[model samples]
Target: MDIDDFGPKEPTCRMLEANDKRAYFIVRDWNLETANSLRRVMLAEVPTLAIDTVEVIDNTSVLADEFIAHRLGLTPLIAEDVDKLVDFRDCDCEDSRCDNCSVTLRLKAKCTGNDVMKVYARDLVIESMPPSDKLGQPVITDADGLGSCIVKLRKGQAIDMRCIAKKGIAKEHAKWAPSAAIGFEYDPANKLHHLDLWYEGDDPKKEWPADEVRIDLDGGPEKTDEPFNYDAVPERFFFDVETVGGLSPDAIVNNGIKVLQQKLASVIKELTGVDEANAGLDGAQSPAMDGGFGNDGYGNDGGYTTPGYGGGNAYAGGTTPYGATPYGGAPGW
Candidate 1:
């Protein structure tokens, strides 16, 4: 069946607020499942570049190599055009390291004389450019210099390491998560009626942000004559997304929807068994061929074969397939 048969063909979305790192929107005509799927995908399924493995060539600092490597893996990298990047598992190269699947970041820092030095994310430089033009730099940076400070160094301390950044889902590790948080709530204004606001002071509106307080004064009843109504409109959800600076909040949301679409398409393909090359053939047929056998027309013994040949059946007299002794019966039982 076509996907449109499941629900509305096209859902409507209205942007309530948006910025570089955060966004708030309202989705209409979609079920709770759809909204929650988007939320989970944004938080855990959306792929982003992160330092997965760190190789410390030399470390003269007081910190252990394992600790330094752990810190490196937690640092988020800039990932703008995620589609252009290839996942490490999908890359053609057989080895664990490859240019197409990973980017190398090098860091070499040392403190001289009485000077105290600090290593930051910016200090670690991308060895090569990513494939996409949209991704100008692999390291996330701003006017404040680097995105975050990695470690501090004393006058005689030094650190040298190579970090490998690869595309990964947050399910494998949280460092790959694109969004910091994704959540949604039912908008009460869509159906709630007789909403009333009572606050002290001359101007009640001044107490809070204008966007925070919203009352539907004309939906069902008068506020002065009735208690507050708690009803909500169905199929309407207000969503909020916060990014971890790897990508813009809008990009995270869009990528989440795209990932969900791809997953659904894969499910549909598996269920329909529509092989593009072998169209019109029976798709329901099992791929495995049945070998001639004694019982079920296949080689499977159904656990009835003699011991030392195949394996004894579950009700066998000597020993069951799981090594348990059968109770009160011959091999047939």
Candidate 2:
């Protein structure tokens, strides 16, 4: 099987602070199968002799860290461990918020006439409606629109807080065990990991149901015509590892290359017309022109003739008294 490394390439953390408080968060394992699958699709699309090797590592801990950073008014530290959290930073706090921990901006003005004010993730804009002091709100956005927060303002004041939404993947949010807390480690030297997938076989829980098994070895195995089939020996699927974390090794294995293969087949079929049938004519092959009365053309009287009612070159034009073109552009004119 080809290896895919779609996870974090560099392991480094960044300090995140909000409002004006300090807190702690930890890194947990991350789960990503869709990204892995998309990477495989890219490999299949490209022409290469060597198969793609992917190693995705998700520091699931980041999820909690993100939430914590957003909750407390403080900057988050970038580290694998909590000890990395520190008080020192480039900026310090002021007012109820902080320049280091929280961001604050203000606007002061009095409307002379009828006007309206609006604040969005982007620049403030006044619509057709007149400005209203009670409708102004705070707007925040990062360099990229990917990160942004918008709030309505009334009476010329607005305050807002941004945090990792509860909708995201996190223990406090949404965590799916046996599929959530999972990480992948690959040894390029050996090209193997602790986890593998099987499609047909017994699992560590004795729930063997794979149609195939894919063993991701840390090192290259000796060349052999035969591969280990989990279905044949249901006992082989039994790994001593606990399924307490993310997907059991068997679960990942069960999502074997076959599933990817089927997907690839479908993608290949779509990308390349290899499976499309070229049988018969793309357009129908009607009989040769027989200049019949049903032909469509100017009749003997120089009037546009309809099919089957034609007295023109119907026979030559494949329009006969009986072979008139249908209104829907059929055999008739």
Candidate 3:
């Protein structure tokens, strides 16, 4: 029998709602540790492209050199296939700044009109990049073509610079963070009373406004009027993930899962002194662990296969059978 049948059932995600930059989903069968790990990975471990170095060629605008450089470093550059790019440290280059490791963008904006002109992120131009590198496109927040405002310039003022975007995670700097904010809450109704919430006014609900979990997911613990369950435990989780246009919300969740799997693989290797990836291939029996350690999360039920994962992807681009419910189990509760 397959080893996955012996361990924790894999956790599954049902996408509640999604847009270009945000997604609402619910995860089931995951313990507090696994759920919290995924949340932290999405916030920190998922790699994305961001501006790391800024070289100001010339600046006559009101903004100082340091200020302009700082603004340039914070611009959100979009590269949908960011996983194809290698991080600077992992590249084969002896020194940093190679076609494989870095992407260079140029910004040259001047105020030709008499009135003050606003220089936006769209003003930045993709100067040079790797052969397969499609990086450093400014994210458009609105239809006005004003992506993210860099700096304003008066008439006869101008700014010129070159920016370098590299692969990185949010742990290094906020510039590389793909998410704006991640809403992680299990019991929104306080029926669990996980925390002894303090309230000064008449009621606690009025003072501590419910988070987006209650407002969004119907599957979440939003039924405040229902009877408080004295015997309930925090089993389900409501995740409202808002990304910053760097990676898709689907990708963020998928990537987080992969990161956890990798960590588990390392632990397995250290404990058993055997490579888990090649465990059963040689007709040698290895230890059976949770379904989370399996390559494909499905319990091999009906020959069901996982989708939305190929290269360095965290999620399948399309819907999977795992959706519509928490589907399976994982290592712990």
Candidate 4:
């Protein structure tokens, strides 16, 4: 809620409505950049537990190992303490698998009766899963527990497998995604002209109808309307987020904000390092980083142009100077 920490403008987001699967909110006093950043981060940055690797000990089912594995990967998992788990690649343990970074799921099903049996997501039993009774399983929509039919088995068909779940983000693989869908919109009325309606006639109202939500919220267009303001900007953003499972809509938004904060903090840290390094070199000047343009850059008072691409920056010589980053240290840039 203390959005001042995220930006200089001190924007705030208010939840308009929310439920188990979906949430609606509005962010005020912010620009398009910040609003879009939240949307993208929510889509691809939020972490979740997914079946990354599968071990098939025995399989007599019709589906191939790869096919069954792919289905299991896309199944929505309930990861309550996903943050407590670490990425397998980042774990410090010597072993390839451990409790710190890996979860084991055991699934074994066989059809004994004459009737055909179906395998469901609920069939996958949680084993070696971290202890977290605080977060109970979601309400099962039906007897199958909202699990789609993975594979059907005849009288003797059977399957035995153990799946390995790991922590990951949607950017790497969509199986780790938490959000089902997210709707982001700003300036819904289009008063700012960010999107122009291309209609055949002069009055576009006949062909293009106004958004019902806008009409309802703003009352009749004739009852109350404000003239277009030249200084207008995207100061309010509306968001509606839906989650697949485990993570609530509020949690998804909060986690996305945390990821965005970390990214901004990283950039700030890198910039601070650059600023310090830029100040260390004595009388060193780089037109690129320091933004000095007066009498030093190409074809100045001497009427002589600098050679090579980028003209007078650190890349002019096609080599990095001082063994440092392009923005910090050295005099070429």
| Per-residue accuracy of model 2 over 68-170 as CA lDDT, tens digit each | 2332211111111111112213224332222222222221222233433333333322221212221212212234632232232334333322321110112
Model 3 residue runs over 4 Å out of place are 1-10, 131-134, 201-232, 270-273, 278-333
Reference-based lDDT, residue 230, model 3: 80
lDDT of candidate model 1 versus the reference: 0.68
Question: Could you tell me the TM-score of candidate 1?
Answer: 0.68
Query: What would the TM-scores of all predictions be?
Result: 0.68, 0.19, 0.73, 0.74
- Tell me how far the alpha carbon of residue 305 in candidate 4 is from the true structure, in angstroms, after superposition: 39
Please give me the total number of clashing residue pairs in predicted model 1.
1
Ranking by lDDT: 3, 4, 1, 2
- Runs of candidate 4 exceeding 4 Å displacement: 1-9, 134-146, 200-202, 214-227, 273-330
Candidate 2 lDDT trough over 10 residues, lowest sum: 46-55
Q: Write the per-residue lDDT of candidate 3 for residues 1-333, one digit (tens) a residue.
A: 573553766667777889887888878766677788889998998888888888888899987998888887788888567766778988998866677887888899889999989988988888876545446688877889789889999989988888888889889998888889999888666657787779999887778877664635435444668887787666678888998887778777766666666666667455434353343222211212344434544234332244322342222222332233232434565
Q: Candidate 4 residues 1-333, lDDT tens each?
A: 544355456677777788888998888787789789989999999888888888998789988999999998887777677777777899897753577887777779999999999988778776774646422222234554656677899999899988888888999998877898999887666666788778898787688777777434423243235666778667788899988885878888877876775676557436434222222221122222342322243214321233222334433333343234545354865
lDDT of 1 by residue, 84-164 (tens): 667888889886457788878898998886866778887877775667654524455478766677888899889999888
Order the candidates by TM-score, highest first — what do you get?
Answer: 4, 3, 1, 2
Instruction: Give me the candidate number with maximum TM-score.
Output: 4
Which lDDT value does model 4 have at 149? 71
**Model 3 TM-score, 2 decimals:** 0.73
Q: Which residue pairs does candidate 4 place in steric collision?
A: 286-333, 287-333
